[model samples]
Target: MGFNPKDAIESVKDIATNAVERSADIVESAGYIIKGDVSDGVVGIVSSSMDIATHSVEKIKEIATGRDEDVDEIGG
Candidate 1:
């Protein structure tokens, strides 16, 4: 058996996706508690979470493929 980069990348992607979803759920709950509505929270959470997840996957792919030049560019 040998280490697989593809599997590692996929695992990271899954982690990131799950984190985004969990964060969204937390935001929705908090919004309902504070504003008595989940619409605003849902809208914002969906938009921002998708962007975050997409960017995370893109960065992970770039890093994995050796396409990422400036590591500092991450999270900036």
Candidate 2:
């Protein structure tokens, strides 16, 4: 029987994908597009690093407490 190159390539791809997903530090891997008018306007984008450990916990508390007013104070 002849050797199949296609199967070998697929196996390698699967291994690489698995390795990437197994890492703990990877939170999300997605792209987002911001569509808006920036003509003659100043646009600012803010972001927080993944190292903020308490951020997730605080958000959970805000949700559970059901405080819309405090939501703005948290990070909104």
Using Cα atoms with residue i matched to residue i, what is each candidate's TM-score against the true structure? 0.44, 0.28
Report the lDDT tens digits of candidate 2 across residue range 1-76: 2234554455446545544543222322111222343331221111222323334444444444443235446555
Q: List the residue pairs that clash in candidate 2.
A: none
Instruction: Give the alpha-carbon lDDT of every model.
Output: 0.65, 0.37
| lDDT leader | 1
The CA lDDT at 49 in model 2 is 26
Put down candidate 1 lDDT per residue, 1-76, tens digits, no spaces.
2345776676677667777766767676567647866676666667667766766766666555455445556557
Could you give me the TM-score of model 1 versus the true structure?
0.44
